[model samples]
Target chain A: MASEAQSSAPDNLPLVLIHRIPPFELSFKSWLPTRFRLLDPLDPSFSSPQTQSLVSSVRLLLCLGPSPLTSDTLDRFPSVQCVVGSSAGLDHVDLATCCRRGITVTNAGDAFSADAADFAVALLIDVLRRVSAGDRFIRAGSWPAKGQYPLGSKLLFSLVNITDNQTWWLFQLGGKRVGIIGLGSIGSMIAKRLEPFGCIIAYNSRRKKPNVSFPHYENVMDLATNSDALILCCALTNETHHMINKDVMTALGKEGVIINVGRGALIDEKELVRFLVKGDIGGAGLDVYEEEPEVPRELFELDNVVLSPHRAVATPEAFVALQEVVIANIEAFFANKPLPSQIELE
Target chain B: MASEAQSSAPDNLPLVLIHRIPPFELSFKSWLPTRFRLLDPLDPSFSSPQTQSLVSSVRLLLCLGPSPLTSDTLDRFPSVQCVVGSSAGLDHVDLATCCRRGITVTNAGDAFSADAADFAVALLIDVLRRVSAGDRFIRAGSWPAKGQYPLGSKLLFSLVNITDNQTWWLFQLGGKRVGIIGLGSIGSMIAKRLEPFGCIIAYNSRRKKPNVSFPHYENVMDLATNSDALILCCALTNETHHMINKDVMTALGKEGVIINVGRGALIDEKELVRFLVKGDIGGAGLDVYEEEPEVPRELFELDNVVLSPHRAVATPEAFVALQEVVIANIEAFFANKPLPSQIELE
Candidate 1:
């Protein structure tokens, strides 16, 4: 049965246009060889005559990871009606153009939500408890030399140096006020995961969601003001780009932590660096950066920061789930059926 | 009111013997002044004159962090009726001796449970998700150079290297079977936290616990055979010392992860190091070692291991809570009331 499913003949198979940058192509071919035929516009061997027929007849477009899907690319395939976004976040795709063309957009949706939310919680605990930093400390052989990690400050460990002992405290997960920037599927899942940690869940979204009991902040500033930690879970849109600016960082304050699993550019990267370096903010746990694969050099030395290489949904299971979703969306589109993860454009 | 509480005239108050080594002294004195007078025989100025009189009258002894409480130490304070343990783990205290002498023992039970459980979950996620390793990768500037940090083998990342790709997979916590060694307070809390992550929880304790629905294994080997990970949360005692030996490690297999937040001696350190170095086990996230403050030098170079100083309950809040519990227990002992965290010996 496995061998029979691995069909490679595609002379008359339904063609789907694959969009991706150089060295960043999707490997969905092996998953569904007989289900559909994928045509790559970026392929160098595609000479004119047959390419025009193939490109003009394609009705579905598969947008690969972080690849820009523009109107010009869409214009080549006038028959294209649906763009299957392989990522949970569709920031790179031109949603406005898709709206104008009446083209439907589908996403991985809940396929990556759990993984991303799990990562958000992981980063939160890792930062709050200093998991990664503690590992680094032990790896550097600093445990015996430094006496103890002292989660808050070294001075707090020595009873002799403690001045106002009653007021002194350290980081613990219970009773922490965490404000989420987005309360979508991933954000809600993050809230669910944090519920048992005894975290106070609040959120700031484009608009307040209905039937949800978490306190809503009208704006990011208000959310930051009330939160001990601000988790950026919103997308990177024109309005949301650099939403977490200097004022927002200042509002979060010196004792606040920031965990970002959303798209980069959601925060002002330079300002965040300055605040972290100046000890103006407490700490940050980042899985995405404004310029990913090129994290700020300043973060390399900061113990308060945890830097990841934009891999919140890079798990093999997520990759498989995404491919299945993309295939199902295409099959649904051709049959005039409701897509599994169709996104309504505003 | 605050000044009235900080009384230094501990002279004539009810005397309690403070049992601790040179550096491991309890700071409970400042928390409850004017309540009790502590007699320390270890003090250089604790010369014969008043020491004998004070030692003879003392009925309570405070055992500070990890300081040995052998029968010999108990012999020094023959009049002591109860030992107040300042930590959650009472392995250092001679519980058998206390039982034989008909002396009661109280510990910091639920006080440190939450923090330790939180740390255990943090370590588990950190190990399985490669949180620390990912941080290290980004810090080392390998993100730009290397494409991504594969949670499993790097071979799984490249589709170009696909050979028997169907059987090859990566790690995700959703469906993982986690076997906990001890389903005590800390272990139960760890299970509660992991429930949201969709993990399958099972356990092995001294015997089957009452009212628990999770599957129970009679021995460590059986638990290891069925688990994707093993979390050690049981106390260190004669039966538990090196309970996770070479046979247990072999049973856990190459894809298994070990998270130890209980005690160092829970697993044989040298054997653990050998297993980790040979990749016989998948990974480990350790907060304690067999010989802590001196981790195996071999672990320093392994990516699959995360080493931390034995500071699982070193949070400031835990410290304050512990101090309060110790004071409460001492107060209850004098009032002939039930202690908050008194241990019953079999």
Candidate 2:
């Protein structure tokens, strides 16, 4: 009853459109400020003529979770000038339509960066150290039946380089060369976190960042060739889709590891599976997949691979941070101030 | 015949007794230097009068692995002035006998510290972030069937203290207060490695380290009370055996985590299992157990627990570093030089 009364607020407050599926609506409503008059499409009143007229007058839309903000949806709200994204990636948003309509877009920029970077490192260590496999081995009552969980590759201060011929020979993480695919907030956080571990950081981005000192590789192939591991942290774009193809995998060689926290399609799933199965590459720690929620069945049996449901950014702290960012962006827009995390459409 | 000739080398080189079970003998032989004439007990010549005389003349005994260097074993080697340990922990050695004989004992020292420290951090991240559990969820094809893998606790920055009632709520690793047990080489390395993650570190050791700055808790319970996590990295000694009992674990409380890179006996296995099963503690990342290779079956069912079969020091890099330390200690002992990694048997 309170929410119903609040939903029918006066016109003094700016109208904001809340876009999310049924499951996430209650949670979003719980944190969102009641000062702003909210218009949720899922409401029964949304189909009424009066509510439709009200939605048409909305100036801001809050994109929540994985809800799609397609062109058709954008066409409904003719007066919407800005879309505040609650997630870091904008792949689900119809950015082209937003750009055409001159709609400003703001994302949950650095809010998820630290958590995502932490997950990236967690996955990397899991793959290299065989954390999950060892857990499985011990869980299946293999410790007593088996003498030891098979030794994992080393992670610090070792002389040998991993090779297909020498899978058992471990190398240290301290001096290993790591190539980052993107140099954005998440990527930079990952690099900063890993620097203390003595990793040799290099990266490949759209352009060389003038102030950054990490070695720059002009292309993914070159980055793979010089790196012991390639960490995918770049946003998924037309140019980046399937960028880690067969050639790049080949350049990464037999002993290389790949840690992907970016997106599933950034890597050629078939090629990656083949490389892993054939020992063409050492291992993989993947949080995202080509078709997530459906990881390749072959990976289930491999001790060298570590797989996670696409949850690199799904942490309680991250969710709270996301809420803060979203609210900050909305408040800034309403105050005629610059959006806190606005993304350039170009 | 070639092996026989090599083992029967002239008196010019220092004679070192190789003590290990059959399994590790070959690996030890592969890495040991040829400059020293090695006497193997498993060899047929070892029981012969000539080999017995040769064994009696040995000045250094190289303990290849977990082979027991008992008081009786020490008595056979009347001239053994130094016992070269090939492993980081020297619990297998009869230190009292070595002390009485004025025999210098040298361990792997800092050689295995880096790898062990790395593994400790890996386990901590894996447990707190549910890295291994998330891996299992995806690998089991639960992502599609289960919708989303559960969100893990935060890792970079968050402000929630873990409590029994809030077991499912995750917090970031960045600002958690971590208490280190032992604060020796591996403990110090673990602290150094975690500092970049923004963890506040305190420690408990035999005595308050004068030069160190971390708050020293003289008792384990006090350390546990103040810590969000307790990383066990101390050696197993008479006083430290079962150091982490029910009381200390209770002090750590429901939301605290325990990471063990030390010997299994450092924690009371039975008490640990009870605490974990009852949800009296948050979670654990265990690489060692009381009766290793015989981990508690109850731990296998818990998603919060991560188990590795005593592999914190089993990496190839560790093995190589171990060889270097063993060689250095032996060379130094023979040259009338101070043993590089000598342990005081006080």
Candidate 3:
């Protein structure tokens, strides 16, 4: 961890503890006072003396990545004014304990919307075009000679007549059914992006979102059966786990494509593999997997699927947004201002 | 082949010798009233009598793949009118001999444009996202239990202060610079697709065409140097071969990405491997290679590059277009009408 620049805050304000992440370095340097320690408190072990130090000076705690915020850990930060999570999802942070302690909690809301949207589209195109497969085919020394290798298929071919059609035609995306699960910022952005592509969007969410163009479906099965493509952009929770199982897979179109940019636990991985292998549905593009890092080898061999290691919001823009939001939340707590991105805890 | 769907053409007219390749059958059921044969002309020991029978029957010879068209071979088809090549590039067919014999030639123009464009865009996105590298990392089993792999850089984060300024905001085209070479139909479509992502389109061609909105660079060197991402969509002829050699490569940006959907001969492959190894360009995506089927094995080891096995036009739509166009030429010749897509033999 780098040394704190210099404190810009008054002498009476409680200190904030933030773990230094990449782009966060720039935001912390820009917005916060020098005295704040952007250090990893999880170093070696969280000892009693270190806990006492945190309790003595820290008025706010900033968290990023997968670091845990247990009640035991938070108890040491006695002077902590608030907890700010630098991510839209707050699964890692224990919100109930913070709420009980009367500690304000905020998050970097909607910061990753563009990154997620861009990646979702990227994954969709990648899978449809078989980009990864092409790369592998070339790398494996099986590249065919001229007039030997097969040409790629076009997306429009699936929509329009290619034979005996003399007239130039554009594909119709309008009236094409698209389903989105979890209508959060990422999903909403995806819906908006699809508008230009001419797909009719439907979503399944616990609550209907107002001021959206897409229609909402109460049942995941209904959405699944009706859509040409199903997008899983929802967060994973106990209720949401395995939301897309064998039944949902059966409802999708034979030529339909599925894209997942959210948590993998929301999908039944074994079923997805089975369905994909049997061509139960068309194809799938996944950025997240049920098992992280260890993507099933079978997925790689399939021509109808595209896979990316869980990195939907891993763009530079998202990182910068994350940094800015985290610093703002920390600064607000120090100056007694309302936190920018507030979160509710059970 | 499948007995020529009963032709009704007069016996006195120049017989059209249509040799349809076996296994991958060409549907000539409704093509025309013509004399056709399923001749294995590609066989090295093909009999001269069979050739003579073809030459005597048809004044026009339509060849699908690269089978040598010699005067001696055509002598058998004395009444043959002309030769129509099925593909775009006339590398396989002898254009000079066709011109000398007063034989008109034609090819399927713009048939693979959309497929090629779609592929170029897919490669660009894959290279930018490091999707290929992520796949390699997981397969290599270097994944850590937690935070073991470094977070790959995103397209959006490279911008300095996009949040503060709109100029920088537009700079993230899906989030990067996209440079195109040869603003032909495929190139133009690529630019159009990228327009939604706010890409700054620039190109270098032999001469600029009219009505194009994007900036044009007269010099290829300048285009290569200025572009953060480069795509080669130019045609292959005397002038284009080895155009992207060492000098042009040197001009490209450090983080530049290259996608070649055009002819493999357009780029100097030896220079490209050297440049990639030296990290002159951040990454590359290629569908065509200098030597067909025999791509440099070193490209496999490089995590930065993505290679496709010349399958850009292998799509179902493109294949259907190819079929329709080939049939059109045959029909036009028999009907004594103008060919839809004529290729002038200079």
B-chain TM-score, every candidate?
0.90, 0.90, 0.79
Off by over 4 Å in 1: A1-9, A29-31, A147-170, B1-10, B29-31, B147-170
* Model 1 Cα lDDT, one tens digit per residue, B251-346: 999889999999899999899999988879988889988765788889988777777777677666676677778889999999999999998787
TM-scores of the candidates in the order shown? 0.92, 0.92, 0.79
lDDT of 1 by residue, A136-215 (tens): 98888887785533332332223344444221223788889999999999999899989888899999998899999999
The segments of candidate 2 whose C-alpha lies over 4 angstroms from its true place after superposition are: A1-9, A26-33, A148-170, B1-9, B26-33, B148-169
| Residue-by-residue lDDT tens digits, candidate 2, B224-332 | 9999999999988899999999999999998799999998999999999999999899999999988877888998888788998777776665666776778888889
Q: Rank by DockQ, descending? A: 1, 2, 3
Per-residue lDDT of candidate 3, residues B285-311 (tens digit): 898887777888878888778887766
Docking class of 2: acceptable
Which candidate number would show the highest DockQ if scored against the true structure? 1
Cα RMSD of all models vs. native, in order, equals 4.0, 4.5, 7.1
Model 1 has how many clashing residue pairs? 0
CA shift at B80, candidate 3, in angstroms? 5.7
Candidate 3 at B246: error in angstroms? 1.1
Interface RMSD of each: 4.2, 5.4, 6.5
